[model samples]
Every structure is written in structure tokens, then in C-alpha cells.
Target chain A: GGIITQTPKFLIGQEGQKLTLKCQQNFNHDTMYWYRQDSGKGLRLIYYSITENDLQKGDLSEGYDASREKKSSFSLTVTSAQKNEMAVFLCASSIWDNYAEQFFGPGTRLTVL
Target chain B: GDQVEQSPSALSLHEGTSSALRCNFTTTTRSVQWFRQNSRGSLINLFYLASGTKENGRLKSAFDSKELYSTLHIRDAQLEDSGTYFCAAGNNAGAKLTFGGGTRLTVRP
Candidate 1:
């Protein structure tokens, strides 16, 4: 039973400011994902990494950048925050298999002013 | 475009009642996963099904790849079950999960 940990439970950023969120997983999984959740909506995938230093863009990756410097950690950077933007960013990890279930972290709530 | 559609965007149930959530995929999917997001924004995985059904405690989930759909049944619902529920469908390969809009469940005592 491993856990996924995300840093900074809450974040407040100004428009055009850059912010970064970090995630770590102890599951030793080969895949990590970043997703964005808006109020009253489902999650949209931003980026995913299959292995260390490997990155793949998802449906919503245009405004974000992701880095997988190590196998156990994945990070996301918001290039330029949008004014009045509010969303929760979630990090998840899964094994390499096709049927593996993803384990998610608590999430980081981002609010842009 | 391949998409996942979930029904009953919101639901209100009294404690002890039972209800089900459903997800339909536009294309055939290899598997389906169910997750519940708590009030504090933590997603708890409930089930992952490649085919047939899997049961855990009071929750049971079923996935039918041929039918391109899945269902989640909650029996004797409790107040703690109140949260947003999401279903994601994965392609035949690794981790191409597309999520549904989610159902907001409010279980009142």
C-alpha cells in the first residue's frame, strides 16, 4: 500500500505569474499523470509520463509543462496563470500494465487573482 | 471523437437508499475505472474492471467492453458516500483514460 503525495495543498497566484506543483509516489509505478479539475466538472488530463524523462501531452496540456526528472516524481508548471482561474490539479500514478488502476493524490487547489 | 457519457449529473439520496451510476462510451473500451472525489478533493479509486463485475463492501461495479458501457451500484448508501463520482474509460493500450463529466451524489441523513 503506497501513497501519492502532492505539495502545496492550496495555491494563490496572480495573473501571468508562474506556479509549479510537485508530486511524488512511493508505489514505484512506471506511469504518472497530471489532471485538471474545474468546479463541478470532471478531470481533464494535462500530461503523463511513462518513465523517467519521458513526457506525453494530453488533451489539456497546451497551457502547461511537465517534467519527470526521476521515476518517483512528476512536476507540472503553469506557464502563465490566467486571471480569475480556479481549479484543482491532481496527480496520479499507475503501474505499466494496461489494466492497472491509478492512485491519486489529494490535489492542489489553485486560485488565480 | 470518442467520448464517455455519464448520466444523472446530480443525484440526491437519503441514507440507506440505493442508487446506480452509469457511463457509456462512444467507442469500445478495453476497461473502465470508477473513482469518488471527496469534499476535500481527494480521489479514491473504487474499482477497475476489464470485464464482468467486481464488488467491494457496499459498492459493486460492472464493465462490458462489448456493450461499451459500465455501471456502479451502491447498496444501502451512507452519508459518507456523498461526493462526486467519475468514470474513466481506457483504450486497449496503456493508460489512455478519458473521463466522464461525473455525477454529484448527495446522500443526506
Candidate 2:
């Protein structure tokens, strides 16, 4: 019954700029994830964290960096925004070892100018 | 080839009508999850099934572990049912879930 909150619902940045997105979950879940979704497409996992200060790279982790500073927060940074990379970034969390279900946050839309 | 494929990339139906969306996996899947992405970009988890079927209100979902497919049936659809539906599947021992291209549903009034 907890919520995941992502800041800056909308973000506009220039190509090559480094943009950071923040996510916070109060669900006390042990696993957190970051995913990207193109318009009319499925979600792609970018990065995930198993616990505090732990990070794992996903299929699309290149050009992206993630950090779990605390158990409650996970952050994703676009190393160099690509003009064609405008998409929504979604944050999700799940209980440890519960890969079956993950709760998602209201996504953050990013547009590279 | 896609590890996961969702059929009827888009669908439109009148309110009170019914329709079903399907997801086919390339290999056996241990679990499947269904989600609805609202227009405002919030994803709501609809169902998570390891096997068999589950129902909540007007939505029913079933996962076929052996057939590598899953189905979501919406009955007596309502206007609020309009959204992008997605299915994600994971193998028996993996934590990663391969996602299928979503199905866009528009329930007309």
C-alpha cells in the first residue's frame, strides 16, 4: 500500500546534456528498477538495485548510470542525452525475490532538444 | 525474433463490449504479469500469475506456462478501461522479465 514517487514529471534537455531523474519508494521493498519506454512501445529495463548501494546493469544500461543512495531512493542519470531518446522513465519496486509483481511509479517523460 | 509478442497492437471496442489480448512467448515462461498504462503515464499492475487464472472485477487473466502464452480478458469494458496493456514474462529461474510490445485499448462510449 505504499507509493513510488518520481520527480520532475516532465524534463527537457539539450542533446549531450547530462540529465538526472530521481525516484523514491516508501514501500520498503528490497529491489528497485529503472525502465525506459518509447512511445507505443514496451518497457525496457535500464538498471536495477538489489539493496542499498547495490546496482545491476540491464540490457540497455549503456549511456546510463544508476545509484541507490539509500534504501528508499534510487536515481538514474542519462550520461549523454540523445536527441532520439525522448521517452518515459519509469521507476518500480518489488519485495525481495518477488519477480512476479513490481509496483510502478508515475513515469517521467524526457525530451531531448 | 521477439522473445515476447503481443497481438492486436491496437483494439477499439464500445463500452460494455468485451475483448481479449494475448501474449506469446518464445520459450516456456515461469510467470507473467499484466499492467495497464493510463494516459497520464501511471502504470497499474492488473494481474500477476504464476499459473492458472485470476480474476478481479471485470478483468480476468490466465498464464499458460507450458504453451508460453498468456491471455487477458476484459468483460463489460468501461471507458476507464482504455489504456496501453502490457505483459512481461520471466523464465523459471531468472529475475529478468521480457516484455512484449504493448496493446493499445480504446473503449469507446
What is each predicted model's overall lDDT from 0 to 1?
0.92, 0.91
lDDT of 2 by residue, B1-109 (tens): 8889999899999999998999999987888999999889898999999999999999999998888899999999999999999999877535566789999999998
Off by over 4 Å in 2: none
Best by lDDT: 1
**lDDT (10s digit) by residue, model 1, range A1-113:** 89999998999999999899999999999999999999988888899998899999988999899999899999999999999999999999998776678889999999999
Tens-place lDDT digits, model 2, residues A5-91:
999899999999999999999999989999999888999889999899889998899999999999999999999999866899999
How far does residue A30 in candidate 1 sit from its true spot (Å)?
0.9
TM-score of each: 0.96, 0.96
RMSD of each: 1.3, 1.2
Candidate 1 pairs with clashing backbones: none
